[model samples]
Each structure stands twice: as structure tokens, then as C-alpha cells.
Target: RGGPTACEFSFVLETLGSKIAAHEGEYADSDCYEILSELALLGRYELRALKLELRLAIEGVRADKFELPYRIASERTGCGFLILPVTREFHDRAFNALQSLSLASKHELELERQVGIGMWKNSEFVDVEWIFLEGGNPPDPDLEGRLAFSYPFRRVSEQRLPPIFT
Candidate 1:
């Protein structure tokens, strides 16, 4: 199959937004509860903008024009789970963005630690992991591995001074 389409990406984001919305009231007493609620609201607007950006980015471009840093699993975890492998950078950027949205440092740190450990899991590949969240259909797996091992790496050769021994 081919890489994940923009529609699939949008669907995944929407599913995540829905799950976040559903849990908005679960931890009302937590310090980061407000931030979680705010994120759910902001996610809707951001997801739309992201879809537009993705559409523009892929417009008139060939399938192989750009490579994704991680893969999408072809099968769902059960029925409503979509497993998405994403780079650590992507994960960090998302949380960092949330932090920049007027969240207190303590709250931000707590939220990151909680969500990172609770929601996300580490995969076998380096700098990549699967996001197994509820909702959305399974997308076709990308034909690559994690970013660190996606491409071949060349080792540098050491130069020797042969004349000095003679």
C-alpha cells in the first residue's frame, strides 16, 4: 500500500479530540484538568488547521515526494484503536506547544509526565512509539520503520598514517 493519506491523519486527530472531550470531566479536581479541557477545545480548531495544511502540503505532490518519520499500523489494536507510530520530536513538540499556552510550569510538567506515561507507550524502535487511542479505522501501514532506522546509515572510515611506520 501507499503512505497514509491526509484524510486518515485528520480522522485520527478527530478521534483523539473526541476521546479527550469525553474525559474532560473525569479529573475535575486535578490541577491540570483545566488545561486538559482547554486542550480539547483548542484541538478542534487546530485539527482543522492541520488538515488544511496537510492538504496543501500534499497537493499536486507525488506519493514518494516526502517520507514520513514513522509508520501507521495496518491493523487496529481491537476495534476502535488506531496505532500510530510517531517520532519523539513530534510528541515533544505537541506537549511543548501545550505548555506555551499559558500553562504553569508545575502543571505543565505534571501533565506531561502523566499523559506521556499514561497515554503513550514506547515501541521497539528508537525515537518512535505507537499511539493506541480509541476511535478511527486502521490505516494502511507505512512501508517504513522508525525514523532512526528508516534509512541506511554509513560509518566513517578512519584514515591511517602508513608512512610513519616505514
Candidate 2:
């Protein structure tokens, strides 16, 4: 009751693979599809079967699992359209992580990247937007954006920033 229902989870699992494949077509040939398909397989199983299946899949992909920098972006930042600043250090780590997972090639990791930000409320990601960052500065989410979200810039010192996925 606190999280997504089984039906909702099933729908997300069913659609997530196709959505990722369509948006990030380069990852289509990688182990990403197999990982996603493993997740999708959970939808076909009952609760008891789902647990066993998920455990097996987790074991299979344990070596490849990498953390996203969402926690770094979220901490101390309140609810709003955040101008999340991604440091060069974070960027490099992210690239290496993706490379390890075979999800990105050197050429595919551009100098400028469009980061997908999810807005969470009441334990759910209510809205998502792709914001482009160039030279570590994100475009004005309010001016160049059409979303109804508010903009609040939370500035953190580089020295205070923790090493990502450590």
C-alpha cells in the first residue's frame, strides 16, 4: 500500500524496456536489454515466484550494478525544479560506470549531456524532465522550459560535495 501496486509495477516493467530502447537506442545491443527483460519476467510470476526470480536476476547482475548520482542531486534539495549541478568528477564516474556496464561507448558519452530529473512527492516520481547541461551549467529551467514546476537553485560547495557512488 505504501508503494506501487503489483499491477502498476508490472506495467512499468513491461514498458520500461521498450522506452529505454527507444530513447537510448545505443544500449539496445548491450546487456541492458537482458537486464531489463529479467525485470520484465517478474511480471509473469506470482509473489512467491517473483521473489525467487528477482533474487536470481540480482545475483546474475550483481557484478554489473552501479549506483546513479540521484542521491547526490537530491540531498538538501527541496521539492521544485532543481538546477542540479553535476561536477566534472561526477561526470567522469558516471561515464566509467556506464562503460563498465557496456551501456555507453566513448564517443556516445558527449561533452554535453541531457540528464533526466525525477520530481518525487509522497514517495512517487510525479514528474520527469530532461535538462541539458553544458560546461557544468544547466539551462534556465524556467525560461527555456514549458513545465509547470518551480525553479529553485540549490548551490553546494565543490569541497563539500562527496565523491559519487563511493
Candidate 3:
């Protein structure tokens, strides 16, 4: 259940303090206008819901500090929700789940053709720029892990298993 657009405008606002704090002198530039326009477009209901949830989670974390265990969230009530926070022993299991999810979201393409796959944190199909991809990352390994598929899906015959003599 999502609108065509979503924003965490209030998150920015909360961190920024008053609205005027965002619009003071040189700060009130085109970027600020864009932010304000974005904020204006938000559904107040959605903002309230997200803010409430974030505040509770933030409060809980603040109470426990950063050492607060990682969580698997369950149903939420007006007061709070059930969360299965990760323990040190099960941290590896949680890590595996997160790593797998990250790997699932990313992709890599070259020359309008895919050269690799990307695993990102978000479940979204985003258009990425070539320059951005080129800037970082070590070479993709030639083994199974995060799957990589180059463009046009080459025929099986294109790759040789090994030389016949070998």
C-alpha cells in the first residue's frame, strides 16, 4: 500500500529544526525549494504514521543505546510492537539474511546491456548511471555468489567447458 510518491520530509525537518532553519539566507536556494516542494507533496497522514513509528523505535534504541540488539519487527500497536531483536549468537544468521537481501536488489549493466547484477538494500528497480558504477567496486568474481548476467543472454554454445584434449 504505497502512493506513487513517498518521502521522509519530516525526518529532514525534524533534524533541521524549524522550517525557517531550512530557509535562512543562502540556505534558501533551489535545493531548499525542491525540499519544500517535496515536503508539500507529502500526505500528512503518512508522515504522521512514519514519524510515530520512527519515534518509538528511536526511543527504544535510545533507552538501550546502540548496543540495542537488531530487530525483527512484528505487529505494531498504538503503543508499540513486538520485535525479535537479534542476539550475539544468532548475529551470523541475521547477517546472512541481510546479505542475501542486499545481493538480491542490485544489478549491473554495461552499454545498455547487463554485465553484472547488483544487490542493493531496497526492493526497487532504479536506473543507474554508468559513471556511478565505474567509480568503485572490485572486479566481479567468476564464480557463483551474487548472480551476474551479461546482456542479450548468450547461447550456451558460446562458452566452452574445456578443450577436448584436456
Candidate 4:
């Protein structure tokens, strides 16, 4: 009996397929390349629960100074990662939609912020990278305020889909 694992696998595959199909145009860009790669991996493995690594390039947060949670235990499930303070208006909506879908996956998916060691940037901006860290480092403490938070994706499905460029 495949049990819940089978159901979870089907759900994950459907979610990934719909999202990728809806946003086929995004794969052409290098920035979203990694995101696309990871999505492809999840679909291949049919993973139900996964940890998302956020390589958050805070405009100033030092690698040493940056902090993460001691553990990862979210009330929701599924793998969905979202970044914050998006400079582009278009990407802002895209990230928001992704967060919503991920939250609704009914799997244990969480987002963690990461920083580069001794890396520096010009302005008060952040670059986010969403990765699957199943056997890698665990998630850090959740960030407060508008800067970061696990996305809430309750009504994610084929009908209520995120905006994907073709």
C-alpha cells in the first residue's frame, strides 16, 4: 500500500507540473534557473516533505551576524520558498503566488534565510534563493516583519494558479 506517500507524490507532481507549465518562459532566465532546476528535481523524486534553503543576500546582513532557527517545524506541508523586498514589481507578484501554492501543498515545507560569508552589496536589498535541503542544513529561526515569513498557500490548486509566463 502506497498510502499517504502515494497521495503526497501525486499532489507534488501535479503542483510542479502545473506551475512549470504555466511559467515556461521563466526557465530562459538565469536568475530563475536554479529555481526551475530544483522544481524539476522534486518532480522526478516525487518528494512529499522537503526543506527549502533561502540564500538571502541581505544588502548588509553579515554571514557571521546572520542567524537561523534551531529547528524546523511548520504547521503546513509541501515545498515552497519565497523571497522578500522584491525590487521588481512583476517578480513580486510571482513570488507571492508561489508562496501561496507551496503553503497549501499539505507537506512540511519551510523557508530559511542564508547569507554569504564576508559578502557585501551596495544597497539595502536582498536576493533570495530557494533550494531543497533535505539532508543538508536545517532551517533557521523565522524572520519577523515584512522582510521574511513562510508563505501562506491554502487555496493552491489547478484552478487557482499562479501567474506563469509562456
Residue 44 alpha-carbon offset, candidate 4, angstroms: 12
TM-score of every model versus the real structure: 0.23, 0.23, 0.28, 0.25
**Tens digit of lDDT per residue, candidate 2, span 1-166?**
2343454335434444555667684544443354343333322222333333333322322333322322112122211111122233343343333332221111122222222222112122211112323233234444434222432222322223343342
lDDT by residue (tens digit), candidate 1, 80-144? 11112223344445334322221221121122221110112134322211132222223223312
lDDT per model, in order?
Answer: 0.29, 0.29, 0.29, 0.32
lDDT by residue for model 4 (38-75), tens: 44544311222232222332321323232221112222
* Top candidate by lDDT: 4
Clashing pairs in 4: 68-140, 68-141, 69-140, 69-141, 77-107, 77-108, 78-107, 100-153, 104-153
Clashes of each: 0, 0, 4, 9
- State the lDDT at 5 in candidate 2: 48
Model 2, residue 53: what's the lDDT? 31
Q: Which ten residues in a row have the lowest lDDT in candidate 3?
A: 125-134
